[model samples]
Target chain A: MLSFVGLGISGFESIPIEGLETISTADIVYLEQFTSPISESDLKKIQDSIKGEFKLAKRWLVEDGNEILEMSKEKNVVLLAYGDPYIATTHIELRARAIENKIKTHSIHASSSLTSMIGECGLHFYKIGRIATIMSEMKSLTTPYYVIYKNLIEGNHTVLLLEYNQDKKFFLDPKDALKGLLETEQGQTRNVITESNYVIIASRIGFKDQAIVCGKISSLKETDFGKPPHTIIIPGRLHFTESDALKLFGKCIDEPFDNSEKTEKISNQMMKKYVPMVREALEEIEPLYKNQKEFEIILDNAERYIKDAEIFLGEGRDENAILSIGYADGLVDALRLAKGLEFKM
Target chain B: MLSFVGLGISGFESIPIEGLETISTADIVYLEQFTSPISESDLKKIQDSIKGEFKLAKRWLVEDGNEILEMSKEKNVVLLAYGDPYIATTHIELRARAIENKIKTHSIHASSSLTSMIGECGLHFYKIGRIATIMSEMKSLTTPYYVIYKNLIEGNHTVLLLEYNQDKKFFLDPKDALKGLLETEQGQTRNVITESNYVIIASRIGFKDQAIVCGKISSLKETDFGKPPHTIIIPGRLHFTESDALKLFGKCIDEPFDNSEKTEKISNQMMKKYVPMVREALEEIEPLYKNQKEFEIILDNAERYIKDAEIFLGEGRDENAILSIGYADGLVDALRLAKGLEFKM
Candidate 1:
């Protein structure tokens, strides 16, 4: 009998109860190390938990001719893999060999990285297209960039998992990954990862220290995203609520402007053109109120319009903000029309 | 804060370690009854383990209104669900609402029916395709049959999960499911389910008293498969080694005819027509052996061929059996061809 067990994501605690049981009961256990590596502490814990001796095998043990076939002939063997057993193609080939040798085989499925932690970033599962892995030395590799570019063209959100080295403590952050993607796009004449292109960077998923930060690709270069096992998400289209959530929780237009002091000096010149329009509105509304009775209500109405306009402006929608500003201008026009009608004063 | 927890497939022991932690930390825990149900003992164990009150809600709590939303405002509410949190659409909708309302939501994913104890049955996970649940009243429902039909047409194996009623313990057995499928196919113009269709019926899966029986779906109707929580699998295609494994571990097939009881009646029967062919092969091969030394080798070869032919015949391969019989015939013809070239001793 051959047993395939998924070690789950995160650590040994993440493994399903049944998966743990299968590993403990197996006679000969072999772990596939290519898909995802378990932590050394977790690996030691699994060895202590299981009765059998666990052996780690490379991709060649299962793929090479007759190794798996000979072992599967008589003795009971168990193959340990990260995430779900059938998630990788190596396990699939091993299953086909076990079937060909007439050996009984079974698999204990567990939570895979593909499906488990994706919900943490608030991305819909069905909307995800092709998944790509970005390496640190990716300039020599063109395949990964092409996959992400093609998936984006199809209007499907692409999830790019950045590679990490635990021993070296060198992990590729989302900003670095976006930089690689930007370089690739520039070379290909595709200006997708621009300063305005929104990207979501999620760090330490499935852990307590998990963080989700959304911003433009250019702005992410200056952001400090802590920790490893980061994933970069490029959203295809934003729903209304998603856009609102991004504005509220994520970075909007409140980013620091470098030329704010210089812009303040020119504020008087800009204000001169709009002062007459502002003064005319203020003059028209002063007489219409006549008393402090309706003053609070009018002020509240104006406050709501200003708040709505600010939110619209923060989303990089100057035209939509103009519409709201026009609504506030109509209120002033109505006050002017009311004053011209000769109200009881 | 709102937490979504998966209860796993089995009783309380089946729940993941992380799920137990979420339940202990939650101020208010609510279980959705539609997706999965918990045993009374397990539910009581959970209630005793946690300090908070555990409440049960129907689909309406997740879908209809913001009852969960209203409770999660100030309380650290946790929603207990069956399987993984995102497997069902209701949980996904609930999570989306929690995110929209700015309520912090966490998901503790666990094992599901999709990862049930399939290892004991000796079936590979990659080989199994889209799963279909066989309801108790399958006679009135066409959904299960259609799913099975589609899976078969797509050349994928289907795992049929027999649904059981918690109140009445009314579960559909694998034999009954097979009969239901056969009847459904008969009702249609196509006769897909035959006496030779290989079906695997596993009863009491994940339990110690698990039983796996592989045979024709028609033959399984008569076999006694004890206990509940049965699963039926219909393999689309068979590889050579899979056929061998089935012959070795699965149910045995009865012979076509018996000649030991009445030799006189067998001699006069239509089955006697093949006796001459068997005799001619034995007579020619007997001449090749001058003593027991040569006769032993010929007898061993004949015995092995007969065993292989029997396995093929039992698997409903009369055509392949005829080919084996022809090979035995060729052995006799070779002896005849050799005898013609030799001088009589």
Candidate 2:
């Protein structure tokens, strides 16, 4: 039998009764070290609770082929993954390998940073898009940037997790992450992210001293959010309620520019130019489309228009491009009409 | 000051250490009953942990305007919610309300069903779509069909949470739910679901002795899954890895259907009749269209032809219809390329 157990987000106390039982009953216990690390104190607590010797598995043990599969045979083995068992692609592969060997597999789940802890910062879980992990030396990689760009195009909020070394003594802070993202955006000529935009900086989530600070990217450079295991969030479109939550719980008062004024100006400009185009697009397409066909067309056209508009904005033709896309959306009845389509953007 | 603390999934043990501290220190604690009900034993355990008194808040206190909000002004209030604090839309509103009144607000999040817990039954979380709650009296409502239909079309899994009523000792069981869903699908003229299809029935998830069974809906109808808090899952598209997992962990084992045999038969029957009329339509539109445009026209015509070809399959067409739809997903790439569009299915 192969069991995958989540040790909860913060510490040992967060694990549910079922998860504890699974860990205790296993013949051999292994912990995946990459996703989220359990502190020595927490590890000791789990050992005491389970009354078993816990072994740490490197990323290669789980990610490499056949090792875990071989271990699953002839033993009641358990793999302890931080957060939920299958949140990462690595664990998924592990489970797949175990199943192929006809091993009795179980996933004892607990709180994950993806959902439970992210909500503590007052962000809606449903509104979040694909999560991005920032590497310590991100210049060598395009994977993280690709995830962020795709998530932005989908108009879903992106959660940026900072990469930490094995010791947990060092981590990529939010300011450094913003700089890296800004540099990447500039390199790619993606204008979606800017210094004036508000980003949420959260530190020590699932802990008593957890801190959440919301401010412009420029202002965040000088502020210390405190501690490791921090994350940054780049928001896409904000709802009225989300905006209100930001104003209240986030450090919106310390913004570099008048956010309300900028928001109003942006809204006014969008309404003036884009709304009419969107209306025209809807009128032109509505007569010819129905059911799934209509939904597919609208989704396809909307994605194209949004992409074009982003390019136009990046090239400094903001007004014409914004209006043109707005008109296109209007023609498609884009004012939340595409909600049923579940298109990311 | 106002605090929203998530009580984690599966009773008292699932809560993080920070959440417990917040509840222990709060002058007034208000737990929302509607989202998730804590067992009496769990409540007693919590009371024993905390030095202060805990108050149970009815649904009215949460939904009613300004009641909880007003109380937060006079007291250091902590509002307890199930799973994560921001999973529900109401909690978002409450946080915003607290912020508006200048009351300092914080959240201590814990476990939520949104995690990879569903994988306990060997199902992937990413494969699941927008979750839909199944009410006890779904016979009178059209929602179940709509939600299931959407999930099926998108090739995503659906998690059907059985409704819990406070006044009555009634909870919807997986057996009744399967029957209800089968009836609803039949009534709507959708034939994707059948007695032979595999369904996962999970009960008392996150608790000790949590039961998970996977089998044909007909096979499961006779077995008692045991206890309250049961959920039913209908899987859409299965990856090779997922298929293996299901085969290993899932109770039902049957010979896998041959896709090639079904597809070839369906294609041959449809091609004999529908291809000629589609070709005729393509010929008429060829003169006015560009090369790329003409390709799109032909593809659209082909899709329309396939839809019409469904009439040939008749009642025996149910299984074939599902298989065909799954195969047409390959043509979806061609359709997108020809139409020069980008969209999620």
Candidate 3:
């Protein structure tokens, strides 16, 4: 039988009581630290508590998984990892492979930093959107940047996990990741991340030295996060309670504010620009078509649709709103084309 | 001082080692089952372990919070809740208030079903989007329905939490929630949910009798989920490994499949309909403007844009695609409106 156990996020004491017994009784325990490294003192305490043969399982050992599966066929084996074991897709895939090979498998879930950090930062877990990982080698941060945009438009918070490569003993700095996101804003021009945007950096969470620091990108550039395994959170709309808690939960260099106010949805941005332009074009061509009876209805319909677009936007029907405005724009521009006037679309 | 502790998901045995020690030594422990009820046997085990005064806190007690905060002014008080502590916003607010009142607050994080359920059902945790809850009193399920649509477009799984009213002893049945979504699909007409859509119902997760059942909604219509604290999962795209794990980890009435294939983004759906309609309209009107040199540029631009819309949709620029198509359709319909003929948009 194979058991996948999580050490939780707070080092040794965070493991579930039942998980402790399961690990001690297993014939072999493979501790995988590639996901997140542990401290030496915590490592000593973990080793001292185990009664079975303890082997340090590297990333490749867990990914390769053959030796572990073979051993589990005859002996009880536990593959222990930091945070919730299955949060790492490697562990989930291995569990599937074990079941495919007719080996009985068990899982002991624990606290994941993904969920833990949000509460620790005093943000509602339900308000968190799909998470993103910031790798050091990524050609662009557009994917993560757009994630923040979508989440912000819906008033959801975004959690971005920094790259932690155990083999290279490397942890991507939160500052550099923020820098990358700001650069992405330049090309993508979504205004998702700006110098004055509020961000929280959660470092060494669930540890004695756990710290949460919040500030704008420019201000946080000079600040040093104490250790590795850091996460950056870009908050959207903040309830007053959340704002109050954030001020107390972390060291905020600036007052807590929403990053979403300045970041408009692409649809909203286009409407803002096109609504006026279309209305102006319609106004210009309406006088020319006053005597033309057939075009009167088209102009009237265009004006009505533009009004409907604004109402739809006010109701948060963004797609329908865009469609209305686009139709109105098309209607007016076509009239301009037929009349031999300079066209605007 | 006040401490917020999590009972994890598996009753008393699943509590973190440190959490157990903290509760055992505290002056008073408030066990709140309003969020999720505890089994009688599990309740007995928990009461037996606590060395402190144990009080069963109603939802109002936790929400009111005045008595707890007053007692914690001098005593070591613990607020024990199901899963993680801060998942309930009331607890987070209470903790924040405790700090505001000059009382020190500590939190012992534990395994949350939010993270555990995904791994338990063999789904990737990172692929999960913002969670939504369904209540019987809600006028409609449109909020969660649209949330599912947005998540599906991004190919992210959605975790739908069912309403559990401890005061009323009511848990929204997974079947009913599915039915509500289907009813919503009729009026919304988004094609986001249908009887054939794949879903997973997770009941009593982290308990010995934990069950994960997945299939098409119609296939699982008669399924007995057996207990409360159930959660429904709507999976988007599934990797082959994820599908393999789903088969092994749970009972499937039908083979595991992707639910996202049928739910196209609204923009893509629009382009699919408008691209051809506009092209056909353009072709019919070509002869009308064949001798008109001034209007040729408008017709040509409209056709080129219609083609650009298709290419843009293929490139995954959904919003841009919708805008371009809308512009082309507008251009075509405007010409059609000027001519004495049937109009198409």
Model number with the top TM-score: 3
Write model 2 residue lDDT over B32-74, tens digit each, in one string. 7676567889888877767665788876777773767787888
lDDT of each: 0.57, 0.62, 0.90
Name the candidate, 1 or 3, with the larger TM-score value.
3
TM-score (C-alpha, index-matched) for candidate 1: 0.50
**lDDT per residue, candidate 3, B213-320, as tens digits?**
999999998888998999999999998888888999999889988889899877877877888888999999999988797678889879888988889889877767
What is candidate 1's lDDT per residue for A1-345, written digit by digit as tens?
A: 787776666567766666777778777678776655567787788888788767877767766726656775776677887766665655655666677677887766555555555455444444454566788876543555555444454344567778765446678877777777666666654444555666777766555665778766666678888766677777665444444444433444333221112212111222233234534554556655666544434434433544555575566433334333333433343343333532110
Model 3 alpha-carbon drift over 4 Å, by segment:
none
Candidate number that wins on lDDT, 1 or 3: 3
Estimate candidate 1's alpha-carbon lDDT, on a 0 to 1 scale: 0.57
Share of native C-alpha contacts between chains A and B (below 8 angstroms) recovered by candidate 1: 0.12
Full candidate order by DockQ, most accurate first: 3, 2, 1
Reference-based TM-score, model 3: 0.98
True contacts kept of 2: 0.26
| Prediction-by-prediction clash tally | 0, 17, 0
lDDT of 3 by residue, A182-240 (tens): 89989987788889999999998898889999978878888989798899999999998
